[model samples]
Target: MGRPRVRFTGRTEADAEAVLAAAAAHDACLSGAPADWEIPAGCAA
Candidate 1:
């Protein structure tokens, strides 16, 4: 299986950041991973 993908659409940068932050927090809580998540170089705007 391949990694899952999430698509966020918005008219501003804040919207995208919010989605990424939320996803990161969700992942950390569910997987017991670190909360500090960095967006990949290629994935960041």
Candidate 2:
């Protein structure tokens, strides 16, 4: 089985930071991460 997925969407830079930090704090790996994770981008897979 694969790791369960978590979705993250960021309209602004701060939103992105909060999502990344929350994932890290939970020791969750952010799969398919982009070079810049804190851009105005949303990630899910």
- Each prediction's TM-score against the native? 0.36, 0.38
TM-score of 1: 0.36
Per-model CA lDDT versus the true structure: 0.50, 0.48
Candidate 1 deviant stretches above 4 angstroms: 1-14, 31-45
Residue 22 lDDT in model 1?
55
Predicted candidate 1 versus true structure: per-residue lDDT over 1-45, tens digit per residue: 433444544436646656667577546554433334544333445
Q: Considering every candidate listed, which one attains the maximal TM-score? A: 2
Model 2 lDDT tens row, 15-39 = 6765676566434345434432433
Q: Could you tell me the TM-score of candidate 2?
A: 0.38
Q: Given candidate 1, what's the lDDT at residue 16?
A: 64
**Displacement of the residue 42 alpha carbon in candidate 1, Å:** 23
> Residue 6 of model 1: what lDDT?
48
